[model samples]
Target chain A: MKSLLQNLARWLVPVCFIAFSFSEEPYQLKLAMSWGSDFPVFSESPKRMAERVAKMSNGRLTIDVIGSEEHGRPLDVFDMVRNGEYDLGHSASYYWKGKVPNTLFFTTMPFGMLPLEQYAWLEHGGGQALMDEVYQPLGLLSLPGGNSGSQMGGWFQKRIKNTESLNGLKMRVPGFAGEVLSELGVVPTNIPATDLYEAMSRNVIQAAEFVGPSTDFNLKLHLAAQFYYTGWHEPGAELQFLINDEVYQSLPADLQAILKAAMRASAYDTYVHSVDVSAQAWADMRRQFPTIRVKDFPDEVMSELRRVNERKLVEFADDNDQARRIIESQLGYQAMMRNWTLLSDYSYLESIGR
Target chain B: MKSLLQNLARWLVPVCFIAFSFSEEPYQLKLAMSWGSDFPVFSESPKRMAERVAKMSNGRLTIDVIGSEEHGRPLDVFDMVRNGEYDLGHSASYYWKGKVPNTLFFTTMPFGMLPLEQYAWLEHGGGQALMDEVYQPLGLLSLPGGNSGSQMGGWFQKRIKNTESLNGLKMRVPGFAGEVLSELGVVPTNIPATDLYEAMSRNVIQAAEFVGPSTDFNLKLHLAAQFYYTGWHEPGAELQFLINDEVYQSLPADLQAILKAAMRASAYDTYVHSVDVSAQAWADMRRQFPTIRVKDFPDEVMSELRRVNERKLVEFADDNDQARRIIESQLGYQAMMRNWTLLSDYSYLESIGR
Candidate 1:
């Protein structure tokens, strides 16, 4: 009788749980990415996250990823996820700044913190909560997808010696950086990514800023330009993962934990991968293109850019309460953290003569 | 009869699988940590990793962590895990250099690559394979546990202006860095963590290097020494997680996946957490202790230290084939990556004057 009861109990447990708990039926999610199918590191991050989630969950949850080439709306990821047309999105938050003003702060800003510093702000210094405040109202959730590390300033056809060199210069820069460049008398022109190389080659634009060496090398920018400038704008540009609140809330507790863990691991993996890719690409570029000279904008030009950036930020914050709050928070955190950065990485690099 | 057979099939499937698979039985592993129970970030990392594993596995796999205070063998974690006395260990790889010569390269080196650079090597540039060559023979598996960011050089009672200033200076610094300092005429002493504060206060040791501000502030070294110097040694010190290969192989595939994902997430979290903690602590120290001045060793002294460090590395590599291979790999990878670092983060910092 005792042996029979034990067998009966084991059988009853699996039967009841399997039938009622909904664990047997797999939950499928659709993810849309802003990057095209062939995009290297950018497209790989979301796919890696999805793969990890599936394995970790033992196939209980699966995510089907569709890149921009299939979706035909690279920039519509935000709306697709928000409206439940897609369950998740992989894109940059700043890409939505035109639709939502506060979205810009989540990505890298001109003269902003580096990758680790920005991560500190996001994880510990109230940046995440502020981000939640903005996204929660739209019934959306956002997670840091990955970082591109620090981007280079741009590729210039000629050396930028002073502020005068920037005046009347036609450059294909984008977004907030374009605005800042326009303030300095440079004509910031918007050109399709495909046309960027031709524009520069034909003297339609004298300079152009794409990503760092890893992605920019694909555009053959080094062949058209002799000077590669150091980065100021888009230092540690972070991409984001967007999820519909309803879709996320409907998942089981364990699945939620699994998804978050997978996202976190993949996000970090992408950053480390980017560092390796960029290092290798930069090395290759230097070896192949001996004429490409790395340059820094003159101190006077850098100072003028900083001054203009600060003024533009003030004007941006003056109108919106949420924008003001975010700007103030970022400024305060940057002030506090910058001292540590100066003492740690900056000092170490200086001592080594990098 | 057909309907009855269909119903019976469903019930029998769950019963047979659940009973035969033994999925209900839990796998519990014990982890021994090198840090004391009260140690802040170091102790917290393994605990967080264990918690995530438990949640993600839905309690099928659990880890019981015992710190050094409980185990009474802080430096014996590598042996303990290897002998299967503990299934896992949380410690730094360099701690085992005396027992295994190749273990030294797995951790940070003096004037070596920074955290991200080292991580890039481990993840992409053939580092993990080399590490496996050393550890796999011992029936051990190692994973990156956490990073301490950039460590400050040390706290000094007097300014170190040149090589002469280092002569006859008694300092508490340990391991390979101490060996380098000894060559420069500085007396390197090892003091217990509990006794370092008193040793500095009584002038038993005129200077000491613990960690950066996050951990160092806890020792209150700033109160005894007013001069804080920037780092040259252990730029980005990474810790390790060691697992018994036999124990790891005993786990189910899904559980194995869960454990790896959890460890990866927690390790990155600890690094991001350390940046925030160090920044906050450094800010607090500045506000509370106005007289604590941060200093950098003069260029002559820095150059001398570098020369000695390079010589010592050559001596270290001369005897062991594995050590030579790791050293060569690190040097080559650093040469390739440093250019990217300079063009990216270093230039960005200089442009902002940080």
Candidate 2:
């Protein structure tokens, strides 16, 4: 009878191995996104990622995406994901600069690399390793979520002609860019997106900086401001996906690959979608509001802003070694990439006469 | 006794179903590529796609990639895939122009939209549907494989200051751009990659148009040529992945999704890789050879080339209804996208004086 039981155990071991190899256990992960439920392209990114994950994983891995409206913690995505309250979160890295100073350089900067250039830096120029170094200590893994392309600097009630025009000017520009503006005597303010239109219409703010045409058109800021300045700050703002290291590690190898591939494809799709929507929206806005005038900030003002920007960057890099390394990496890569950009796309556009 | 037999059969059916559900068969696919095995980013794209598919599918699907060097057929990828001789092919749409004239517009056109703009048109504009219309009739499915970004025009032995300089110019340029140049009395030739350096050095060809810095620097063209021209043709050349439709449909749903996600991610990565490599190669070349001069064709030459290109496009459109529709779609979208490009990235770059 004992010999019979041992033989049965030997037979069952191979059976269990075969079943385990073929029948993967299903995993369900929850994702939090930093947008409202109804947000157009922004909301669509994580949803697309989830759908791809489900399809590619053969229903073995499913991701449930919830917007900030449902989660009620738009600004706390980093904290939530790091603490393992959620498996993942989609938000811009710069939003967490207050908590992790090194996070600021991962998004975009004043007069920074464009979308492709920034992507090149992240994927090939040690930017990803630096990013991991900063996030790993906090128990988080981050991937690029999407890009907003080059942003529009702001909408202004009056054109900025000189450095003096910025003096005592009130505007709603947030983050590092706002700090740079304040150096030029602009009174930078931050307001909720919901209040932007009302603030501009009621003269609560003299100028407002928001995203480009796609999202900005939703707020109807064009009706309130006549002069639209092209982007100087946030040249190519990239959003990020934050995952808890433990949750990521707990997945099977195949599921991990599926999650990463889905996230990457969705991020790229979002950028392409932004480009499409922004083009259509800009064309529509200009057609309806024929009086809208696009202006570039004057050379004098731009030079002063660049000067102040350099000063602030140096000051920020003084204390923290990680911050200093990140800034230097970006600056050095930007210089090399900008040279190529000037030779290729920049030259092509110029020769064609925009 | 018959009733007992029937009961036994019914019991065995459920057990068979459970085992079948837990054990999936592995699938293998064969892919043919246009480039040689040593080709840098171009060859890497399909290889990367195969790797991701294997990982994401947990070894359920494996792809074997064959390059032109091994297959001895560089331009027959479309036909091979369609005929089921190969399950997939990595090539460019423009290569099929001889067989299907409409395939020409899917790849980059002379003086067409840049990379992101073209991607937007393909994804959000009607480009993909149109591409499907062209390829579906041939029993193939196509996806964007990768982009070379904006290519440098070509290496020139002499600076071309006017259209007259192009008369009897023995240059090796290919495809529709070559056709356009032929109108200006330039003799456009096609030479094998192995002979490009020798041809240019021996005065067998006064100029040659190849891919940009990353690939071009490999041929040592700068050693023989003094002037490098920025691209007027192939602004954003996108390679394609062609799959046999029936073979694609044969895959289980999850494997199908994995294949597509892998391709998409690999394609985007290839583009990012190109941007990085090109930037690094260009910087290195300049540092090593400071004498290489980069030039843009003068306005006289550019306007004339544009005029000829338009004429050819019109002539080509007249013959085929599908061709006309595709060209019109591109033109319409380009008109709208160019406006946004001018307002956003173009404006920002000009403001910075790169």
Top candidate on lDDT is 1
Task: Give per-residue CA lDDT, model 2, range A1-354, as digits (tens).
Answer: 655655555555555544443444468889998998778888888999999999998788888899988999999999999888899999999999889888988889888888888989999998999999999999999998998888998999988889999999899999888999999999999998879999999999999999999988889999899999998998888999899999999998999999999999999999888889899999999999999999999999899889989898898799698889988999999999888888888888877654
Considering chain A alone, report the TM-score of candidate 1 relative to the true chain A: 0.95
Tens-place lDDT digits, model 1, residues A1-354: 656756766766656555433424689999999989779898889999999899988888999999898989999999999999999999999999989989999989988989888888998899999999999999999999999999999999989989999999999998999999898889998898777888899999999998999988989998889999998998998899999999999998888889999998898899999989999999999898888999988899889889999998898799799999999999889888889888998898888776
Candidate 2 error regions (>4 Å): A1-25, B1-23
What is the C-alpha lDDT profile of model 2 across B234-353, one tens digit per residue?
888999999999999999999999999999988889988988899899999999999999999999999998999999889879988998999899999999998988887888888876
Span of 10 residues, lowest total lDDT, candidate 1 chain B: B15-24
Fraction of native contacts (fnat) of each candidate: 0.62, 0.59
Estimate candidate 1's alpha-carbon lDDT, on a 0 to 1 scale. 0.90
- Candidate 1 stretches with Cα past 4 Å from truth are A1-23, B1-23
Q: Among these predicted structures, which one has the highest DockQ?
A: 1
lDDT (Cα, 0-100) at A149 in candidate 2: 84
